[model samples]
Target: MTEQNEEKPRNFHEMELDDRILKAIAKLGWQNPTLIQERAIPLLLEGKDVLVRARTGSGKTAAFAIPVIQKILNIKQTARHQEIKALILAPSKELCHQICGVIKDLTIKCSQEVRCVDVAPQVDLSVQKPLLVERPDIVVGTPTRVLKHVKAGYLDLKKSLELLVIDEADLVFSFGYENEVKELMGSLPNIYQAILASATLSEDVKSLKSLVLHNPVTLKLEEPEIAPESQLTHYHLMAEEMDKATIIYALLKLHLIRGKTIIFVNTVDKCYKIKLYLEQFGIPTCVLNSELPAKIRCHSVTQFNQGIYDIIVASDEKALEEPGNYGEKDNTEAKKSKRKKDKESGVSRGIDFQHVANVINFDFPLDAQSYIHRAGRTARGNNHGSVLSFVSIKEKPLLEKVENRLKTGDNDSIFKANHFKLEEVEAFKYRAKDAWRAVTKIAVREARLKEIKQEIFNCQKLKSYFEDNPTDLQVLRHDKALHTVRVQQHLSDVPEYIVPPTLKGMGGLTKRNKRKHDFRSAQSSASRFQARKSNPLLSMDFEGFSKKKKKKN
Candidate 1:
């Protein structure tokens, strides 16, 4: 195998090619072909199928795209836009749009041989037809939507389809769209060349390889090992559910970190909660998730891409697939079920961030693969990045397991986030150093509030129990815990509403500050309600107040 590869082409430039394609490559300012690009491009240009297994941010897009461009340029494409000669299917809308951007950038330097139409899930295909008909080269889209067009007879797959490129093959299969993918693949011409690429290959990818590829060149780009002298480090804090926010606050205040930080949470509620907490502390930040309106999500990503925001809090999966309420179903079990379905379907893959210099794991992933995906969001594309995790004592065991999976014994962590000054969370304040700290505190308080509410529910049951069976110590203990949680919740949630003339120890924050704080607290809940609307994260249930009120009424 070594001798065979030694005889193969050494670089993309060495491959048999045209001056137009060569000029297009140089015009794009590509320094050199990556390993995958170098190994796969020749086979691809020779009209042979190819399969690529590599890490994210390894330039797999270009590895396949360059050859697709060469093929389109080599072919005699008519001026008519009704026929799409090449179809590039991506697992997510972001990846599809991102791939289209790369093609567009390259097409600018090419001899007008390529034009791409991006068909996404939410986009109207009829509206797309006019634009698509004007460009007769390539069609890039997510699977289901593109398949719908193919099935509906809107897309001419049989006549014009010359190449079928499945980017993120593993993601597509994982999303549970294998049946649809297979159906779509069967619909395409048998003579067409097939290309598959993925960050990781699983059983589904293996099956697809056997089904689709023929005499394919296989390329694998291993993740470069962390150098002994590298500055990037990993660490997790053992935190109580309540202490997470406080830890985040402490990390932010040290002011050593800044420049496009990314905070990863498991759910969208956490994303909004963290953002709200940071913004309250005067941190200029934004969020990226499927729940955000399409226009707003695009605008936010555009701004983040433009370096307009300092921090972006999002779910790891949201960064990969189409933005939608996949993980936020009303039924917890149903949500988990759907997430499992999506995972099996391949829609819930991961994404990489180009500018994210720091990644904070507010919620630990369920497994080692998830942990790697979360951390890989940073340190992308040869750039050094840092990862910080907040894990409670209960979660530490799982963190240890993940660490072992990464094959490293124990990576060093700066326990004092303040000491390292890793990031300034107040991105908008221009000087708000502890933005993440404030957000983290808010997250802690919000959690405390939820615990209090649950306790209140349990206490109400106990109150009913005591009315019938009084003097139960178990119920009594639960009652005490309930009251304690409520008091803490009031202190955290209604800080401005509660007047602490003297804290547990510190005499006072100051008489003037105290009065201002009281006035602020008084206005906070009402203003917060107005600002947040009906969000379950911010809206308090009042613990069966409606039932009691109805009884009184």
Candidate 2:
């Protein structure tokens, strides 16, 4: 591949793109090009293959998307419906929809001339056939979905396609889509320009580079994997398995963590465990793990982004051990019957969780990349965000390993000890223990079952049918509570009498109206990383976490 670097173009106008494209950029309020856009756009417009490594939320979508739209617009002016001019492949269904959405936004003015369709939905081929029949200029989907379309005679990337972009190239391999990618590449027209955009140049990404790129210009930016220490503050709090719930409950109840936030857990079980555990304390959360269906997962993110929910409990990455079973959350007969990981279920990496203020690692990430993807969810687009990880005693080694990978200078660990000591929330001890006890293993499993069942019926095609037949929807509705968690209503409200002095001014953001008022007032106060610090944990003695405690087993 060609190893030449081009001079940076300061803005979108400098790239000599179509005027309509520039107008759309202006409409979107993009005053200047991001580093990725500045470097990658010009090369892409030049019709050269590019392998880019930039941080997430760095406008990577627009970097390749702008050129793709511009070229299609230009072609539409002269050519008679240039069918399938571009194909964008992502790792998950959520990301496919996201990329397609970006393209549609950019083509707002040119929508009539240049159309894009997301072929990643888990709907029937017959359902999507009409859209594919129109032969959209831009088709976005995961590798398998795109290949499925090609095999089913719905998409024709072998001839008319002029550009191919593999967004989140690293994840395509990790998701075990290398074979689909290779097969898709072989069937594609060899002369089409390609762009491989990813956060890292992992072995998989490099392999993708060799397979698709023709003397591609690799753009590895000097930026860090995550936002800098200033924009994104990283903190790790030590907590054992049992007390993790107690700490999270106290933090959210007292409003220590605020703004739109995502709590990342390791296993699918942990996603529900923290979510259901918090619910016992009257904290509501949306679960966005791999167990949920694609349409529901995507809708959950959209709703979360639109401020419908303040918190989302999600699993960040794939399975660490087996390749195929990666991100596979359940081993129940229903889940085991289907070998495919939730095609729509993904959070980190490609799917954008907009304006996220905080990322709490409820379970310390299994790997460094998982942590990076989780961290990338927040502090995006020049916005300030924070990461607070709960590290247990044994997980300290994993923490060190993650910090080691993040080291730029000697001994410069990116994650530091969280200054917020768990001790200050001692007032909530009895309540927290009471709440934690109510969250049983049965509740977690029940929560998973209900989520899976509801989402199964809520899938796009079925939902459409149910929309016309509303009574059927009502008939299939789950009326019963998923779990028997003895939710104590008093746990939802923090009485003013017990309010800690340090956290006094906020008025414990428990009440909805008061919380909104306090939230706005707090936002106006220039306290972005506000209220993180608290005193040390008063007692690990409450549970089996104490060293003096005997082994129950």
Candidate 3:
């Protein structure tokens, strides 16, 4: 493994790339290559197999995408006929779709010469056969999906395949696609140039490197996994398990944590638990988890990037530290139903969350790597961000692990004490309970069921989900927690008395400022809805809520 961190200044024009590729990069508004792209692109273009260990949001996708497309174009120049030459496999379906989109964007100028298709194994195999039948120059899908197609005779890649890319390589085995990956590798032509790109060098990643790369030139970037101290801030608050809800309630309802934020929780149920508790006070939030349909998950991310919602409660990180949601060859016994976690569907792993200003860990992550990846969502692209975690007495050990990971770097400790006193917002405790109380267990169950039905039965998009599991009985096990978030408009407003005392010193952010922020958030949501009527995904479930909101007014 080679280590290279020297970032010599270089631009897209400096690299030996095709004119059409350079033109597409300009259209995407990329002024220069990122450090990872600058270092790895030249090596990949030279046909050197690479094992890349870089953090997320480090432009790693384009690090491989640009070279992959350049090679496809290079092949097309001399080859007489087109064939499936490149295969890109990601752990989750969402990541697969994202890579496909990025590849397509880069191939805009040379689309006629290079073809790419992103497939989701979660979807019915029959539906994707046509996309595979075309024999695209590049095929992007999960290892499971790619293997299924190859076995079904829909995709013939035993001979002409030349390039293989496994993005998010650490997550491949974690998602329980190890068997599929091994089988797919056994079928592929062994002479192809390969790239195993991952954010971390976990045991699984090391195992994959031995299996995938061939005398590969390793590039372990010198950049710290965590952002610089100047660009981001970290804070920790000690709270009892029972009062955890109260702390987050005070933070958001009092306008303490400002800007677009992502609140992270551990279980799928917790995602809804927080969203519903906030919703009881007329807060608008979206729930993201693995159990949800792929379409809904993808659309939620698109709307979030577009600023349709400021707060998103997501169940990720260790939420995906379970088995992949595939293959029900075993009998439907209670023990066998543990395969509910969708390895490919995680918000924390990689989902392209743009301009996220804050990441609040409602529950601390299970491991150091989970914390690192969750933090990766924010402090992206020269933008400043903050992560505030609620640490309970029991969670102190988890907190220590995260702190120790950061201690190896420049400053000793990154996690700071809570800037604001919890006593200042003590008056809001009863109100927080009132809101939290309304999020009954029954409500969470209904919300979970309704969410599944809305995306599955209503949209009929869970072809892969249903195919793997014989019944929805297993959903009840993991989705036993969650809440319906719509409520009266009066609950949305923050009463003047609920303002914390010491917090007033920070820009005089009184109750009025909180209201002002809410008003602006609402205005943006309404404006975005009016601007794009054709995008119904963003507008889903708003009509009924608006009617009730108007009645409350």
Best by TM-score: 2
Q: What is the TM-score of each candidate against the true structure?
A: 0.68, 0.86, 0.84
- Please give, for residues 221-319, the per-residue lDDT of candidate 3 as tens digits: 888897887776787878875577877776666544556688898767777778778777656777788787786677677667766667788986443
Name the better of 2 and 3 by TM-score. 2
User: Which one wins by lDDT: 1 or 2?
Assistant: 2
Worst 10 residues of 1 by lDDT: 536-545
Which residue pairs show collisions in model 2? 1-215, 319-327, 423-536, 423-537
The order of the candidates by lDDT, greatest first, is 3, 2, 1
Q: Write the per-residue lDDT of candidate 2 for residues 1-553, one digit (tens) a residue.
A: 5444556447667788777777888898888888888888877888888998899889899899998888887787788654889889898888888888888878888788889899898888888999989888888888998888889988877879899999988888878798898888778986989999999888999899989989888888888888888788787878886667667776666555667778887667677777767766556687877767787777777777665567788876363433222223432332444424574457876888987878888877767777888889987776777788989887787788789888769978777564444556666777777666667778877888877877776774587697789666443322123455767667667776555555566543545444543432434234423422211121221232222442221
Q: After superposition, how far is residue 39 of candidate 3 from its true place, in Å?
A: 0.6
- Candidate 3 ranges with C-alpha deviation above 4 Å: 1-8, 317-339, 408-411, 461-489, 501-516, 519-553
Candidate 1: list runs displaced more than 4 Å.
Answer: 1-12, 16-29, 77-82, 222-232, 317-352, 408-553
lDDT of every model, 2 decimals: 0.57, 0.74, 0.74
lDDT of 3: 0.74
